[model samples]
Structures are given as C-alpha cells and as structure tokens.
Target: MPELTQAQRNSLAILLDSREERIRAQMDAANVARTVSAGPEASDMADLAEQGAEERMDDAVVDHYRAELGDIAAARIRLARQTYGVCLDCGEPIPYPRLQAYPAAKRCTPCQRRHEHMHAGPDGRR
Candidate 1:
C-alpha cells in the first residue's frame, strides 16, 4: 500500500485521538454503573430480581466498552506502526471515508464482509 499523505495521517490521528477520549468517557460511565448497586439490601423478591437484572446489564455495558477500548488501542498501535489504513486480511488500503466513520476498522469493506460471513451463521447470526 502507498504511504498515507501527511495531511491524511494528521487527520486520522486527530480522529483517533477524539475517538479514544469518547471511548474512555463511555468506559468511565460503564464503570460507574457497575459500581452502583440498586437496592443492595432489599428484602422484596422483585427488588432482588431488579437488582440482579441491573447488575447483569451493567456488566454487559462494561464488557462492551472494554472491548471497544481494546479495539481503539489496537488502532492506535497500528497508527504508530504506520499500518493504519491497510487491511489486515487483504493488504489493501481501507478508504479514508470508512476510516473517518470507524477509526478502529482493521479491514477493507469486502474483506470485512467476508470475515463476517465466515464467522456468522446462515441467518447472519454472529
């Protein structure tokens, strides 16, 4: 793949930096939700059930945010390695528009679609 122009690289770097900040803030919110317990000492069964559900939901949110953070970190590493826009699967350049939309994207659209197809079920269930 050709080298990204200086301006393109700069724009991508700025986008990645902003993305990191948003992800960190979201992760912080997730952590806050995880830490706050709803009716921890409730005696009612319904309250207990609600609390359990809330905890489960909070855990899911935390896990999702953590996964996003991992992706952002990997993207940042790729930027540092000068491989940010190259697709890992096909070694093709991912379009700038796509990168602007998803800074952590690691593959070109076709390759990414193929990967998803292979990983997903016939019904597109992941």
Candidate 2:
C-alpha cells in the first residue's frame, strides 16, 4: 500500500479543500441562476432562450464537478487509509510528481498507460 508523507497528505488536504469550495460555489451559482430563470414572466423569448441554454450548460458543469468531487473525496478516504498513492490497477506506488499533479488519480503511470491502451480502440473492441 502506498503511504503519503505528512507533507504530501497536508498538500492533498489543501487541494481537496479548495476544490470542494470551488464546487460548492459553482453549485450555488447554478441554483440561483436556475431559480431566476424559472419564474413566471421571466420569459423575454430571446433572454429566456439564452438563459435556458446557459442553465443547461451550468447543469452539465455541476454534474462534472460533482463527479470530480466524488473522486477527490474517494482520494481523501484512501489517504486516510494510507493507500493514497497506490495504483488500483497494478498495486504499484504512483509517482510522487503525478500525485502532486493529480491527487485523485487511482493508477500509476504504467498501469494507466496500459489501461488506456487496452481501451483505445473504437467500440471497446480492444
């Protein structure tokens, strides 16, 4: 199992906290925009159409952030378990630099490369 140094743990905690805050803010903004766009007489046709499109985009963005936050939360749990830097695919220790760059990553470079290669072909034929 891969174990993070105290400093690395602290760094990951900070990054996760920042990402959580950002996602929360975005979700809040999206909610407010959605509410404003949903009321009666809020229809200026052009404005309404644009707001609808923007709201849909915001929903998609929120979904993406939610998924990312889930990954971050899972990473945090793995950190607490002292398994934060181990590759899930190969059971190898993930590189420290890669961990710094992607704290939520679940695979080492080689395992990730092989996984990507295995899934690269169209229609999942590989």
lDDT of each: 0.83, 0.81
Question: Over the stretch 15-46, how does candidate 1's per-residue lDDT look in tens digits?
Answer: 87898798789878777765674425868999
Off by over 4 Å in 1: 1-3, 121-123
Q: Tell me, by lDDT, which candidate is best.
A: 1
Cα RMSD (Å) between model 1 and the true structure? Answer: 2.3
lDDT of 2 by residue, 3-107 (tens): 567887788778878878888888888888778867665457888788778777877788888888898999989988888888898788887788778778889
* TM-scores, each model vs. reference: 0.82, 0.71
Q: Alpha carbon lDDT of residue 105, candidate 2?
A: 84
Q: Please give the lDDT score for candidate 1.
A: 0.83
Q: Root-mean-square deviation of each candidate, in angstroms?
A: 2.3, 4.1
Candidate maximizing TM-score = 1
Name every residue pair that clashes in candidate 2. none
- Which ten residues in a row are the worst by lDDT in model 2? 35-44
